[model samples]
Target: MHEWALAEGVIKTIKEYSKDKKIEKVVVKIGELQQIDIDIFKFALDELKKENSMNKLSIILEIEPAVLKCRVCGKTWSFSENLKELDDFIAESIHFVPEVFHAFIKCPNCGSPDIDILKGRGVWIEKIKFKGE
Candidate 1:
């Protein structure tokens, strides 16, 4: 899964940021739009930690819901609210090309195809709790 690559990047970033310090905990915020497999991501992190002898490191993952704004009506709403309206094929298509979601999905208020995602677009490291020397 691509989550492995993402986990690897996270690990690398943490190693760089922590330097000689020991890492105690890491909190990651994952956007819902990313559709990451949490199990795979966790497994990758665990494996990396084991390989690096960082058994004490604790990993926390949080999922952020996507928020979308309508360009025509200025209406904002959670993407989860309208998920049921999407057909299976359209959903699959959007999963491949998220930028084209507006082409298939319309604003709930004005029925306009013009839309913009206000939040929950990518993954990020939220917090890092480290042990002081």
Candidate 2:
């Protein structure tokens, strides 16, 4: 699934970037809008790491809140505040394609459909620590 793919991507990226260096720790940031299953992602990472012979590597994941800004009113709000309004189908859609959020969500303050995603849209590596300084 996507989680597995994402895990593989992380491993591949680390391997490519840290060539010949042993990785000590990797800090990855997960955007809430992606709706990734943290437990599954971690498991995938562990399995993939082992397969890649990265046994000593430590992976850390951080969840970032999805923030949206109203284009009309300039008000910012957290996605969590509007989660209760989303149906299962819509949630699933956003999970796979976050851009779909624009169709389902609106500015909370101004009730405007014009909104901008301020943060928490994708996954990325925040920091990487090698085995030695």
Query: What would the TM-scores of all predictions be?
Result: 0.81, 0.93
Off by over 4 Å in 1: 87-100
By lDDT, the best candidate is 2
Candidate 2 deviant stretches above 4 angstroms: none
Candidate 1 yields a Cα-based lDDT of 0.82
Tens-place lDDT per residue, model 2, 1-133, is 7789989999999999998877899999999988899999999999998999988889999999999999899999999888888999999998888899989898877799998888898789999998776
In candidate 1, what are the lDDT values of residues 13-116, reduced to their tens digit? 99899999888889998877656778888999999889877778888999989899999899999988867788887766665556667777788899998999
- Give residue 119's lDDT in candidate 2 (0 to 100): 89
lDDT of 2: 0.90
CA lDDT of every candidate: 0.82, 0.90
* Cα shift from native, residue 65, model 2 (Å): 1.1
Question: What is the TM-score (0 to 1) of candidate 1?
Answer: 0.81
